[model samples]
Target: MTWVFLIGAILSETGGTLSLRMASKGGGRAWLLAVAAGFVAAFAFLTLALDGGMPLGVAYGIWAAAGVALTAITSRLLFHEPLTKVMALGIGLIIVGVLFIELGAAH
Candidate 1:
């Protein structure tokens, strides 16, 4: 389904971004490979979702929102990064914005 692909894109993008961070911190060959593969899969899955008829506006909005939220949460869990109240609020806003985009597309 389109939703499945979209979710995959979001997760892969998140993984790629996290791997990039790790690579930057000297995580070496494995991390670099992961970063490259993750990004490649992310874009591939995103294209599949679009091919499955998910509108660009809605798909991209959801992808960006979910990626950011998941990344922030994962960062907090994996790296003990600070996730302040402001960051939470921003994530919530992104979700709301995506919801609005989806809703608007239905009309």
Candidate 2:
């Protein structure tokens, strides 16, 4: 299903972003390889979602929003990163915006 592929893309993108952070902190070759694989798989999954007839705007919006929210939460859990209330509010807004995009696409 398109939703399945979109979720896959979101998870892969979030993993890729987290891997990038690790690689930046000297996680070295293995983490770097993970980063590359994650992103590549993300794009592949995204393409599959679009090929399954999901609209580009809707798919990309959801993917980007979910990726940011997931990455932020995971970063805080894994790396003691700062996720202030303001940032959380921003993420909420992004989710709302993506919801609007999806709703509009249905019309």
Candidate 3:
């Protein structure tokens, strides 16, 4: 449950950060709302996650890595950013690392 909440927080936070970047160029009202809502939801879920049993190290690691992966993907799709093979492999490794951390807590 805590890990779930942490993942949710990571997604929302990355989403909010992306939205904010889009809004920076001036998208008017809708983008502003998206950015605001995303950030609020991100922090709320993160706080809830901490209230659960998730360790700080695990939580932060997951949060940051997920954010980086999501942000990279979004940038590539939405902003025409480049993604090399090495970057993709690195992201894959990060995903594996997160899974390992989660699995470590199971026993």
Candidate 4:
């Protein structure tokens, strides 16, 4: 289903972003490859979701918003990165925006 593909895309994108950070911090060549694979799969899955009748605006907004929020959270959890209150607020706003997008599509 479209939702499945969208979820895959979000996870893959999050993984890819984290791996990129790891690679930059001297993780290993494997980390770099994981980044590449993750991003590629993310795009492929995104394409499938679009093909499955997910609106471009809605699907992409959800994908980007989820990816940003998730990546920030994961960074804080996995890398001890600083997640300031402002950042959390921004993430909340993104979630709200996505909700509006979804709700608007219902009409």
Q: lDDT by residue for model 3 over 49-101, one digit each (tens)?
A: 88896777778778888899999999899988889999999999999998987
Off by over 4 Å in 1: none
- Predictions in order: lDDT: 0.94, 0.95, 0.85, 0.97
> Model 4: number of clashes?
0
lDDT of model 3 at position 46: 81
lDDT winner? 4
Q: What are the per-residue Cα lDDT tens digits for candidate 1 across 6-104?
A: 999999999999999899999999999999999999999999999999999889889988999999999999999999999999989988988888889
Prediction-by-prediction clash tally: 0, 0, 0, 0
lDDT of 2 by residue, 22-97 (tens): 9999999999999999999999999999999999989998999889899988999999999999999998998899
| Model 2: lowest-lDDT 10 consecutive positions | 94-103
lDDT of 1 at 65: 88
lDDT of 3: 0.85
Q: Is candidate 2 or candidate 3 better by TM-score?
A: 2
Screening candidate 3 with a backbone cut-off below 3 angstroms (N, C-alpha, C), the clashing residue pairs are none
Q: What is the TM-score of each candidate against the true structure?
A: 0.95, 0.96, 0.81, 0.97
TM-score between candidate 3 and the true structure: 0.81
RMSD after CA superposition, every candidate: 0.8, 0.8, 2.0, 0.6
Off by over 4 Å in 3: 103-107
